[model samples]
Target: MANVEFETLAALLEREGALPSDRALALLREATRTLSDVHAAAILHCDLSPATLLLSSDGRVLLAESALARRLGEARQPDTPATERIAAPLYYPPEAAQGLPLDARTDLFLLGATFYHAMTGAPPFDGEDPETRALQYIRHEVPPLEQRVPGTPVLLNVLMQKLLRRDPAERYQSAAELLEAVERTERMLQKRQEARRAPAAAGAAATDTPRHGKRPRARQSTAPAEAPAERPPTTRRAPAKAPLWQSKPLLYGGAAAALALATLIALLSRGGDSKPQATKPPEAPSTASAVAPANTPTATARKETPRPVVEPPKPKPKPKTSTAAPPREEDTPPKPQDPPEVTPRRWKAVQGAAAGTETYEEFLKRTKGIEVVDYEDYVVNWEYAGPYRDPACAEKCGPFDNEFPPEKPGEKPDWAPLPKGADAGRPWLFNFRNITQIAQVAADRAAIYLRTRVYSAIERDVQIWAGSDDSIKIWLNGQIVHSNRRDRAVRPDEDRKDVKLRQGWNDLMVKIGQGNGEWGFCLRFRTRDGEKVEELRADPAGK
Candidate 1:
């Protein structure tokens, strides 16, 4: 009921890190939907401040004293006690309410208001007091969403503006529509987050390796060259540095070479001592024995083993340095997925007047041929002459008094009887049946005419029923009126309402045709105010 209470709700949400409870949120959602669907004319919450909402154990719901609930014509007192109050009333501008019927769109505005308050710490239309806020809701324009929350999606902002439109028709037609827009905003936000993180992850990977690479290289380059020889003794003393053995490829290679040399020396000593002492000839043996002593078996073995050890050390160190390159390659992050292109689709006008197709290409072709009228809200209006010319059919074929009786049984008229003193004669009737003609204009712009004359000084009303696959426009007495192009059937009886009539002779013209489906027109008129004058009738024979 007060701003203080609204502040309290905010405090609670901040502390909890979420709305009061799922049940409360669900109740609010359902209530919002109900209000939008049934009372499209009413604004659910005239004052959308935090205090109007009550968060109970069950969840969050509107308080009875909330301006919206009161405006909705609820009978409950503001102070009435309840476990939960789910609905609020809304106030509508009298003119807008009278002109257009309320529908679900009205409630969507409230929902948006609710979301705005929840996300921002303030109401969308903040004011000094409840009365001021109500006035702002009625007259003052709410600030753009960016002003409230920076980086809001344009689509979301536009949707909120539409929901809060003064005219109900301009708002979303139902709660479902508003929900869809909300869901889309959520998806867009998710995609944006993904897009932002992709580049960040790649950059992080790029920076990581250089930081890690510098440390190891610095330690290795600063270490003493004699560090290798000291490593084996250090490993024997402390096993903790045993892992360092794998790192000392050069030291390991030297140790392997020393062990191989010792083995080769032992093998040669056994071979020489056991072999030729007895088999040598006197002069040959003397030289061979002297050579063997000079070149001892141990020394010969050491030379051969050292040669192989030197080669192994060289290749072993090369492979270790080569192995380091793969880690650097591994450290390089995989390429980031490219962000999807976000191309916004905007509404554009396709055709101009002059009986041309409204397709995008057709609209382009007629650029130089017709006048294009631009209306508010990006609506385009065009006019073109129809395709059909007057037909040369015989005029004087039917008698004026000829009445074809009803075809079925029990399909009687449902009209109120004439008042006591009223003088009522037979009603004048005209029927145009079984006619096929095509206008020169494209099918979307065809016009059919039913010409007739009326003789009366009194008030008269006429109704025209027409069906077309594409579109239809009806006019009486030169006034451009009654147009239907929606993707629904056009019923003559239900669609045509009462119209004023003029005295003396008059022409009733109806232009109807299939834009895409079967095309036909039907009309009926009755004199409500004046006496019918027989002399005023135009004779078809004379014409």
Candidate 2:
């Protein structure tokens, strides 16, 4: 009744030829479960009209008369068991009022009636009035399904007929059994379709090679004849007259001239019998002078034979002493050495005001590195000695104070007491919402000390955001609390459980860049309780 919408089952059946077998069975099962869970005695009355059965948007189940009973009858009269009874205003069968015991099969019969209408896009029993349909449901037999809707499966038709039997005992025993029969029939039909398609696909693949064979053979036959026809004309025009350099006779003549010159040189080299003039017996033919006959087959053998022995000249050593000295060894350079390491000084300063007669106004103007030394468990004393390491704080020096009120009315305020041995120096404090900047924070054993007050009571939980390029440690009171030595972003939100605050004043001390940034740090706090707090501005006047 709360903006409920209805869609007729007849429209769905007409659009999608028949309900898928699985979907139909699933609908029936879900309907049974819903009825069981609601403790409905039975879905006693049956309405078989095309418009009465409505399929829900999920397409899983039909919203039968139970939803109507709950909306119209039960909602109006909460105490009455209207959903259990078949009353006039809620639902119509007067016979159902006679107390016929209903069970799961009664609901299955109604589902069968819905299925019949869905398959045919029309009710099993055709009647304009509800009374007529009710009478038919009780007495008349459903018409043969195939006669009304041709091509309906024989199994489905028989199932519908069984469901419409006048006697409840003659119908399918339960919805589950009816659903099983429909599923078996659907599977058989699907298997048959797949069997028919398989052979068709194989035949298509078998015909593919023959279909492409003709083109390749036709190209091969025409290619050879075309190549010969294009080649003859190019060959005929190639030779006009050969160049002299390429003539065969000229080449042979040049080779003969070269051979004759070589023979003449060999004769001249064997100087004509010169031994007669000297009158000495002709020396035996020297081994170097032996020559082989041109036609001898032993000429190659002569060239390969070993000649008489000859010794090579040996290299002589120089005299032992020399005037010049040997070149001195080249001078070698020395290896470079590594640079020395610089160890950083830790935070040793205390937190609070310096000891002097200087006014609070003058103390605020001085920019110096202040040390916060923790003496007791809960107290941190601070002192400012001189300017910060930064060039901006050159010669400034004054007394620093964080105490609440002045000692006398309208008189200069007293400086907060410092822990013993805390030297006065420039104090570093950074403030921003979401932006980032750099500041030099120096201290001894303790980290850098930050002195600030929360203006308004933060009604909601908040986070203090802090980060540094080097090592950093944060303290709320004098206690050394959160530390991030890994040089990563610091989020107090992650440690929100550890942070505690009163309504008025809150102090934060952070030591960062221990040896690096002169212990530099940058931090801010933000609320995380889903509400933004109006933060107090930095008030030098209040101090």
TM values, all candidates: 0.26, 0.28
Q: Which ten residues in a row have the lowest lDDT in candidate 2?
A: 394-403
lDDT of residue 444 for candidate 2: 17
lDDT of 1 by residue, 269-326 (tens): 5444545553443444454456567567655675577566566543435556666645
Which residue ranges in model 2 land beyond 4 Å of their true spot?
1-59, 62-99, 200-543
Candidate 1 stretches greater than 4 Å from native: 1-103, 126-132, 199-543
Q: Model 2 over residues 334-408: C-alpha lDDT tens digits?
A: 335522232122111111223456443343354122211211111122321111233222111101111112212
